[model samples]
Target: MPATDLVTAELTLTGRITTASNATFLGSIGDVAVVYKPIAGESPLWDFPRGTLALREVAAYQVSQVFGWNVVPHTWLRDGPFGEGMVQLWQEQDPAQSAVNLVATDHVPEVGWKHVLEGQDESGQMVALIHEDTPALRRMAVFDVVVNNADRKGDHILAMTDGHRHGVDHGLTFHRDHKLRSVLWGWLGDALTVEELEGIDRVSEGLNGGLGRDLAELLSAEEIGSLAVRCDRLRLSERFPAPSGEMSAVPWPLF
Candidate 1:
């Protein structure tokens, strides 16, 4: 869909975010928290791969809006300390909380709050993951599958204090093929709930209305067609389908 027309002024860099993979800077345009990443002018990390990463991130955010999930608010692409880049409205999450702490063999009563965990690896590299699930979230998992999201890490889920879940970091989504790799496997063999089917139906119906035309500008025809196919399958099955090929199962260490 066409992005919401939110006017964002040029943000000024206030400090450095030492924990991020790229050269992230903390900034603000008015009262909004902005994260800035400049294009690499020198040697760069292989994982980021430069060039189209910024565009991909923007596209992902737009797609997330279609799923009706709370996402890190995307404003616009702009010139930054490095070069052309993206600026997102910063989401305030508990810095000390993580999903790992929430999961246990003993079930915790579903309080409907999901926590986003941001931490460093053994070598002190920053990483994030999501760690909360409810009946509502299970529906989101099915939405991720329809989008062919290749990265749905635990850190991507953000837990707000008021018991709402926000997902982030969707740059690696909308593949034309089945590339879904996530850590949400609790419902591996469970039947798809009726609510889940309804959610998918809403998205599919929205596609033909406005969403399809908008996505056509950013995604290939094949990719959009694949998304429709996924929706149809879910609607027909009325439950989670068994893994058909190697790609259907969740990927390990989903980050």
Candidate 2:
């Protein structure tokens, strides 16, 4: 099936995302900003472990929903012109704004990192990153730790004009073993706030419901169980735990 048949709107390819492991396109579904990945003729650079990218992206979106953060909109998996691929609601970010540029001069206010990467969704339409110091981002950091996100680079963060920080490029996540790597180290040793703790509780509780069912299809039983185990360890430790074992603390830079 073509992308149009699986998706609701007509897709117009704006450009290609050459930076990704797979061939991705920046397109619009009607008026929505969307990222399109085609499975056919995928780049050979993606030689990581099996089920690595898709599983990680899906898990990240699901966990973001549980934590109530504004993650990139994940539409559905469908058959596209290239092959089986995933479609995501596109995020519009100002070309001039970046977390890297800002981090040099000022600190990201408590929980306000999400709002810094806002931009126009489509038609050059602008949206502001909603800025508020809350426990939500803290919780997200914890989730990243548990899942072992190895690519939380600064550029992956899109800061909206309104101040909402949008996280992108979650393809490197949810390793069965510890593989967490990121640049959000400001809260490494900070204790989990009450709200943050509650969010983790919510994810733990969600595993038995829709979240569990969904993960069962994409991840192995051992992987799913490991996710729960990480949460438990985080809860018990009450702070960012030190890295253990022989795995590298970061991913090899593809660039």
Q: Kindly list the per-residue Cα lDDT of model 1 for residues 1-255, writing each as its tens digit.
A: 223322335567898877555566778776667777664522253443445445555666665666666443564567766777766777787766554343332344356434333456566666543345675457557767777666777667666666565666555667666777776655566688766776678778877978788777666677778888988987887776555566535544654
What stretches of model 1 exceed 4 Å from their correct place? 1-8, 15-24, 37-50, 71-79, 95-97, 100-131, 241-244, 247-255
CA error at residue 146 for candidate 2, angstroms: 3.0
Cα displacement (angstroms), candidate 2, residue 136, comes to 6.0
- lDDT (CA) for every model shown? 0.62, 0.64
Compared with the true structure, model 1 gives a TM-score of 0.72
Q: How would you encode candidate 2's per-residue C-alpha lDDT over 184-241 as one tens digit per residue?
A: 5556566877766777787888888988888787667887898889888888878866
Candidate with the greatest TM-score versus the true structure: 2
Worst 10 contiguous positions by lDDT, candidate 2: 99-108
Best by lDDT: 2
